[model samples]
Target chain A: MSEIIVNAVSKTWGGVGGVDRISFKAEAGTLLVLLGPSGCGKSTTLRLIAGLEEVDSGTITIGGRDVTHLSPAERRISMVFQSYALFPHLNVAENIIFGLKVRGVGRAERDEKLRKVADIVGLSHLLERKPSQLSGGQRQRVALGRAIIAEAAVCLMDEPLSNLDAKLRHEMRTEIRALQQRLGMTMVYVTHDQSEAMTMADRVILMRDGHIEQNGAPHELYNEPASDFAARFIGTPPMNIISWQDGAMLGVRPEHIFVAERNGVPATVRAVEYLGADSIILCDVKGETVSVRQTGYCSLPAGTQVGLEWQNRHIHLFDRDSGKRLADRAPA
Target chain B: MVAAVMTAAEPKTARHRNWATNVNAWLLLLPAIVLLGMFTHYPILATLYHSFFSLGRSGPAEFVGLENYRYMLDDDVFWQVLRNNFIFALATVPTSIGLALLMAVWVDKKIVGRSFLRLAFFTPTVLPMIAVANIWLFFYTPDYGLLDQFLKSLGFAGHNWLGDPSTVMTCLAVMVVWKEAGFFMIFYLAALQSIPPELKEAASVEGASRWYFFRRVTFPLLMPTTLFISINALINSFKLVDQLVIMTKGGPNNASSLLLYYIYEVAFNFWDTTYAATLTVTLITILAAVALTKFVYLDRRIHYQ
Candidate 1:
């Protein structure tokens, strides 16, 4: 098994910002995304797994081998940095085959592998160009080519697509997912963008302040968030959380709540955001801001009174103080 | 009619404005141009003009084309000094540069006492060359010098370091390298720090050994700084002669005399002003050629960020 098991790993610098006792297992051939905001220790966790940073406590195993104390070279892994980190002086082909040359691969084998990897990454025509000569997307492709050329079983990516524009990011996202599936490489991708995690990951591990808030498949995190933090972190226009009675919070996805004619929680429409395929109607309910996602256009103007309603099955209850999800659903 | 007249007059006003802009630009450039021409360009031209003429000792100077040049070709001392300069350059340039790069790489690490190490390496560069020469002079003194004392303690015979002809050039070369390497280290240190840490991380993840990564990535990336430092070091090898005045004085039969010191001797001591101009012309030609080769050839070969 080429799975990566990070067992209770903790790394902190000078009693400051770092991951704390975070543990997760990335199965072989699956893309596990470490998703969080900045300074949430997502990148640090990836670095620890790559052996770039040592775990202060606990054991890290890659393919069932204890590799916590091993050098990065002995760990048998590859990583793509957010900056791409292509050697500026080397041409694309040289950069891609640098690792092969370091490992003493012969010229013939190096050239053959270079050609294959170049073709795979769609950089055959641009082999001789330096990184300064390539576009951002092309540089990213070179970085990708370099990472995959080693054919390491576990590949770690730290916000690799964060440098690209929106459209290119989406394109590279799908391409990377497809490539990971094709190569059967266990990938631990880190990203701050929740949409990237929701779309690309086989499993999503949401982190908050160095602790794992939730860990499950993407749909599972979206549908059944274990805490209010996970519920708010998963979806776009994320799950609507509002103050409820008796020191509890009521959580419902924006898609679950709808405008009703009568006999629902009364709210005032504060504003409307009209996206092309859908719209988000922002409403004020008892001095708390909650958004409701609707299909197509939401033509409700500001200051209009509306009643929001959802089914009892869609209601989620959490303790206000702890933010932990309560097992029992609210009354209908 | 008025419109046509205005159109015809527009060109004249535009020309006037252009003339004013040109004058403004020239005014802004006037100080630098005047200073360089007076101090640098004029001296070089005067040297070249004087090189072809005879020194007027008892009468007016007369045109003596190629006389000094022929005499310089026949001068054994001049030939020896020229050869000595080449050897000195060859000895000091590469050694100093290599040591500088080594020191820079060492101090750039997160080792213990890194700041202290950096300061220690840089201390030599801050000392004036005359003071440095004096310190080295004390060390190279014949019998009771530090070097001799150490050698005597080792049961070896104390020998002349700077006084002997055989060891004079080597001694001078060693002193020059020691004095020069620390300055060049600053450049290499800056270049090393500018390299993004992510590149090292990426290389490490690819199973690259530290030495392998340095050979392939770090070294190639530092090529521009290396070229710059080498050219400066080469020029300095020819130019710097203050230390020779203090320690060797081109002594014991001009064995350690560089071309510049020989030129100083010919110009000031021997009073051969025209011949001195000829030597100066040759020195300028060599320096100009070195600078030109860097600009015309090496700059293209190096990779600048």
Candidate 2:
């Protein structure tokens, strides 16, 4: 019953459309990630759901209640900020129980919940330490702990792992996803990182320029992007968007493009970046930069001529003007 | 070992160079050290030395160790001035700091004419205390003054604002708070601005009321700034006697007289140098105690990152 329905919500901030008519429904006990590049209004949509921001037009409902006008506290929700936003003056234990204290939760219940949350977040020993004393990862755990302790139906996270280092981000990402599942809390996460969206989201709402480009599962967005922007944004190194005649563009994932000695489109290698697990070979095909992802070390020198081949179904066509995907693939 | 010892041994000129460096450092510090010695240390020690002596009338002075201390304890005016100073600090420091914090919060908001509001609040701080007291003197004037005229128009009688024994200290305290709160506000503004806006936003999401957020998060975070402003307000309460000189002159039974003003009166008006020196020692002790409290207690309680 904690399903959130954002109904055609639009929020214009500082003369720019923060989120324009963005509509999506996050089902109960699911992790829905609002993924997009910066300024794509993903965070704005999350804020609207939390009621931190009012919709310029349209409505938002949470847990079967029309909460478009309700303040964040009135709505049964918790949020973890990008900066963690831990109270620097309060110790870790106090920070986690702040919301409960504000709501006048009894001391016994608060302490009991605090102990359980601290054990889950691994912050039992650090209850006495202030936020300043905690490391970045530990601070992030505290933020997560604070949100989870609220026992709200929904937990909204705004790039909770972005402040951490790569290793910590990976660890926290797994921890957060696991925590969400264990608690069965409906969570709406916002981030620009596609890998995070692809790996963790039960459903990913990809946005661009204040509009939802596509809303589906991670692999659905990856395998069948709705437009050139969605196609390029959802994949690693992005889909290579090669322009064709008649205002059409061909989209292909880098991993799908296989490099052979001869048989397909002839291209010359411009550069090769060795990334241990896989090497990305940058090739120049008729002056358009095309990248090919190959397993293992690819030591081909610059100017090495190669043929790129892919299955007919792998190529995605889009209208160059509107950036919309075009069906019925034809020879480029 | 021979080579290590040979390398460790200093050259003849190296020792001379080290001595030269020491001499250069002292040369650079000479002016500052001399000024501090003559103006600060010498005066402090001299005041302590002088407090033990009796004022001489065209003759050599004699040592009167505890005589001045006993007189200070017995002098009703000195006791009244001391008590008034305590009351003045207690009345002004927290009130001004609280008002300063409120003004800072108001000005920090995106309100209309905020820059003008800030300027209006801070203008009193820029004006000389004597000029402010003179301006307020007209406002406090008994019958035809601004306050009295306003009160008369409001269907009430006007009382002597500055002349009344009961109201003199309170009037001065109010004026001092008005003149000083804005100056303290600048520090609060800087501290408040430095607090991340995201914290407030996060608090909003957590459903903390404005007052609750302020009590738990904002106020605790601003403890260092409050301590800083409190110390300044305390020191100013004792040192700022210009308005007392201009408005009340510690008159009408010495109700409004502070310690520093009384010291000035004893030293300059009565030519009791020894007594003034004793009073100066007391003022210094009070200020030193404040500085100690700040460094020892507040600093430990509020960790500044």
Candidate 3:
């Protein structure tokens, strides 16, 4: 079942705008992530779904009912915020139980649900502690517990792991993913970290300037980025884009290029980054710096002459004037 | 030893430079020194000297150690006045803080004709408290006041406002709330401005309705600000006695008499100089206690990220 349907939804601020007529869906129990840079409208689109912001146009359906004008309490959806938004005055149990209490859920049912959620998120030992007393990771779990106990059809998380340090973020991301699968809850997560988006999401909706550039499975987005923007945004250190003259927007993944000792190909090493697993060779092809992932080729000094080689079919081409990906390159 | 001492000294010119740095530092603190001595130290010393002594008729004051303090503890009127002051502080602090918060939320919403409405709420704060008292005095008049006229028109019997003992304090409370709520609202407004908008939006998305959001999230966050405003309202309640003077004169037989106004009467009206000195000491003590709480809280309240 499609638990959420955002149909032509758009929101524009008074001066600068956010999401522009974005439409997408999340199948029940599937995780859909709105991935983009900061100020790229990923969070705004999430806010629109949560009913925090009114859309300037379009309708949203949850559980097959039009809920565009409905208030948040009326919508059977729960959201976990980036800051966790834990009530400082309320202990963990109180915070998780707040929404249910407000909705008149009976004490026993609420308690049982709270226990289940706490157990799932591993927060049973810290029920009496306030948000201030909890560390960042603990707070994140409490926030998840808060949403989980609601038992809403869908859960929306807006950059919930950004506040944690890098190590904690990785651990919590895996924990959240496991918990989601165990519960089979429909989730829409927003984040800018490409790695987190790649690892945590079943489907990633890559956005640029308030519009969805491409959306697909993580590997699909990686192997088949629809535009230069998607290619550059989807990978670590991003895909190496070289400015080539004469109607070519050349891009290659750092690992895709090899410094083979082959003839009739042109390149020169400009700068070398000695990464233990893979060296990043910054080569000057004419005047452009081309970053190539030198796998098992670490300790290569700068100014080392190397021939650039690649499979022609794997090379991507784009229309330089429009920045649109050209599926078939013009004959070389 | 001489070489070691010379190294420690650096040079005579270096010592001169150190002296110059000291002087520059003092110069930077000059304004604070003058203001502190003028506003705090001198008055405290003068009050301390007066509190111990009995005033003689047209001569040098007599030093009767703790005599005024003992007299204060025994005076029936002084006790009554102190009780009334405490009641006033309790009544006004809560009412003012609550009303101020309501007004801040109302104005922050930018309701219809928002600028005009904001201006209306804040106008009372700009007008002098004495002037506000005068306005309320007319409103509270028994026969010809607008309130009495409105009551009669609505088929209800009109009654005295400040004239009635049961309602006099309530009248003062209402008047003070009207005068002070907007001022406190400005503080709340500043606090409200500093709250991240993301926090509220997050709440909205959490399936919590407006009231639930405020109760769970916003109210707890605004705790430190509420404490701040409570302290301000407490101090202002003791400081404002102009209404008692102009509207009630602490009368219909001293029903509305406050600690500060009563002190003024004892010192100046009765020429019971010794008794007045005693009253002044009490007033200073009460004010000092409130000021000390404010000082401590303000110094340590800020929590940085």
lDDT of 1 by residue, A116-231 (tens): 99999999999999999999999999999999998999899999999899999999999999999999999999999999999999999999999999999998898888999998
Report the TM-score of candidate 1, chain B only: 0.96
DockQ score for candidate 3: 0.36
- Chain B alone, model 2: TM-score? 0.95
All candidates in order of DockQ, best leading: 1, 2, 3
State each candidate's chain A TM-score: 0.98, 0.97, 0.95
Mark the regions of model 2 whose C-alpha exceeds 4 Å error after superposition: B1-31, B303-305
Query: Which is better, 1 or 2, measured by TM-score?
Result: 1
Task: Write candidate 2's Cα lDDT for A269-300 as tens digits.
Answer: 99999999999999998999999999999989
Error of 1 at B190 (Å): 0.5
Query: TM-scores across all candidates?
Result: 0.97, 0.95, 0.84
Badly placed stretches (over 4 Å) of model 3 are A14-16, A108-111, A241-248, A262-264, A328-331, B1-52, B58-76, B83-87, B134-172, B244-248, B285-305
Calculate candidate 3's fnat: 0.48
C-alpha lDDT score of every prediction, in listed order: 0.94, 0.92, 0.83
Docking class of 3: acceptable
